[model samples]
Target chain A: MTSSFLWTLRSFKHFVNGSSICQAGPVEKRGRGRRPAAQVRGEILDAAGKLLLDEGMGAFTIERVAAEAGASKTTIYKWWASKGALALDGYFHAVESTLAFPDTGDIERDLLTQIRAFARLLTRTRAGRVIAELIGQAQTDEDLAAALLEHYSGPRRQLAVAAMERARERGELAAGVDFEVVVDQLWGACYHRLLLPNLPITEKFATSLVRNVLRGIRA
Target chain B: MTSSFLWTLRSFKHFVNGSSICQAGPVEKRGRGRRPAAQVRGEILDAAGKLLLDEGMGAFTIERVAAEAGASKTTIYKWWASKGALALDGYFHAVESTLAFPDTGDIERDLLTQIRAFARLLTRTRAGRVIAELIGQAQTDEDLAAALLEHYSGPRRQLAVAAMERARERGELAAGVDFEVVVDQLWGACYHRLLLPNLPITEKFATSLVRNVLRGIRA
Candidate 1:
């Protein structure tokens, strides 16, 4: 296997927007008579993802992944340092396939689309349960929190922040709108509803939310 | 012990803001030998709080509370239907003593005070950990979620909404502000930081948060 194969293990976004790097593209292979490392890595992530979907976070264990993937514990550890790392990789793989960043050029509409999609994902999918489990786990587990922040949340927030910056340049947003605060309020509202489940996170709610916040930010 | 002793068991917030019925002179006794039910109730709550503080949610059991309070199982069951109910009472007892509603008459300042106090309670107290435990538990436990919504989150949210309504009536808020959305954003930001611990929910942050949202809502 080429270094790119190892790179696949290290980097996510293997597939996006109707195209998959894992297929329909050239893969650099350097070895003969041995399966490519990329294939092994893909198998591991698939097993991890299945385990998460099947039994939720409670049953997500590195040892269990080893058994499910028919690989040794050392082999699993060599690829991913801990269960948190492995589970995150699996989570990203799941989330990326299902959700897309909105870029409709209309900032308010884009935000509505993005947040509504997010709310739906958290409330409607099996992945929501897994995300909730990890969030609860992250409260006390510093290591898991760090991994999730670095891999999952950080990239997602960057995308949203970039969208806001683009809107500012387009004169869609006011001169002194703090994107961080706006982003926090938007995302935080959805998260609060998810955690509490006392309020409904309907599409209408998302639309009203974006409109209300944008009223202040719009020039 | 008179029926007034039993009344103490049924009522919460018996007193607030410096005047407490519990400590406002002695009561006339109607029974000769029975212990005060209020004292018994206090012992149970204290024991439950201690268990939550010393060991955490895992060790918080009704059986354990019975042992800790030196009360019989039947007696404990007579008051609370489940561990969640008992723990919630303990949590409320802790929270009520420490936090107070903000009524500074300045809408922005009132919000800042309320949210800052909330952030401090969640970050600086042992009850914070217990609350986190209950939030996580609520994700899976339907019954617990209902009880928390009714007893804890519902009332807390009502107070916040009332504050926003007061602001609107004072013409400090815009014509069409949704108090629920605003309340969600303010409280949610703090909760998001609490769960993730990636961001600081400092006093400055709380002040900034209230100011930012209020900018959107101000007339």
Candidate 2:
């Protein structure tokens, strides 16, 4: 159900461009003289991203976003039901280009490479703070929490799961190893370090982490 | 340095009670009569905790807390330097009684017991949401982040470290076991489950977690 919600949101962009007609059957425009829906959505996301990056969560109000985007409240609401949805949309839009999972033959090597890259993305870039803010605020906001689980966290987790399954099939994992638990420890340590700021999530840290967990679960 | 800061805060209560005279050596009052400093501090913490619990972070402003506590902003600032410090204080004040690290002879059992209790505190109680808010806001507020590490996370981590060191001394752990890494994997997994909310962090999950990590590191 949560995954479907995320899928609907992703497909919304396609639907807006008249490429898909599954849910809500696209938005109807008032006049033919209006700008393209995609352009408007892009502007909104651009404004939202800038607001989040520049000012953090304190300035991420819908009213301010609308003002920044030069769009009306009705126009923004026509696409996103809440501020959380819009913020998540802004997040996915910002990171989709760089968010890739590795699939090298060696699961350990692949995991280490990917985790190191992700650690940098999470700690070195603005995306890290932005993502942490969304995660933090997601605690109190149910809609945001659901949206984050569905859109942001779900896809990445699915990739990790698939990779673990492939490793298991190749007899690379210990007997009775739970891929879910493996992924949790791998990704969880990264997030914990990011949020708690007690440890540095460096490439060395990532390598040692992958080595430790792999040693624990290796066949 | 942060540990010292936490110690200072803890001693603040004693200083306010006219029982200890270290550091600043107590506050000097003006005029003839005044309320007990300890009671005033308690009132402030009570008001802050209530605001954080009842309304969440949106309403947890120093101005509002002062109004709720019927104390001046100056009075609140005299003890706490910022909102983050105050919020963490409130969290510690509220949960100090319930949060205890287990030290059973078996490291695995002790870890599972303590982690399960912590997972519950993070998910089943108001403390979960309160903590999430602090972590969320801590992303942008550096002061709050430091206080959280020093006051809330530091002591618990020390307890876990001590327990692991004891285990290693007993030869219950593998040679060259890194207790820091072990604690990270243990607590990080729980925090990951808490923040992502993708999986339920139950007792069974904790059991499996402790067993798996112990399998890797046990002698």
| Docking quality (DockQ) for each candidate | 0.21, 0.23
Query: Model 1, range B1-219, lDDT digits (tens) per residue?
Result: 212212222332222211322322222233344446667667778888777656656667888987777666776666665565566566677676555777777787788778888888777666666667556656655655665676677778888889878877777777666677776788887777777655666777777677667665212
Q: Sort candidate 2 into its docking category.
A: acceptable
> Model 1, stretches more than 4 Å misplaced?
A1-90, A174-178, A216-219, B1-88, B217-219
Model 1 chain B: weakest 10-residue lDDT segment is B1-10
lDDT of 1 at A210: 76
Q: What DockQ does model 2 achieve?
A: 0.23
Q: Candidate 1 at A122: error in angstroms? A: 1.8
Each candidate: chain B TM-score: 0.66, 0.62
Tens digits of per-residue lDDT for model 2 on A69-105?
7677887877776675676566566566445777776
For model 2, state the Cα shift of residue B100 in Å: 2.6
CAPRI docking class of candidate 1: incorrect
Pairs in steric clash, model 2: none
For candidate 1, chain B by itself scores a TM value of 0.66
Q: What is the lDDT of residue B81 in candidate 1?
A: 55
What is the clash count for each candidate, in the order shown?
0, 0
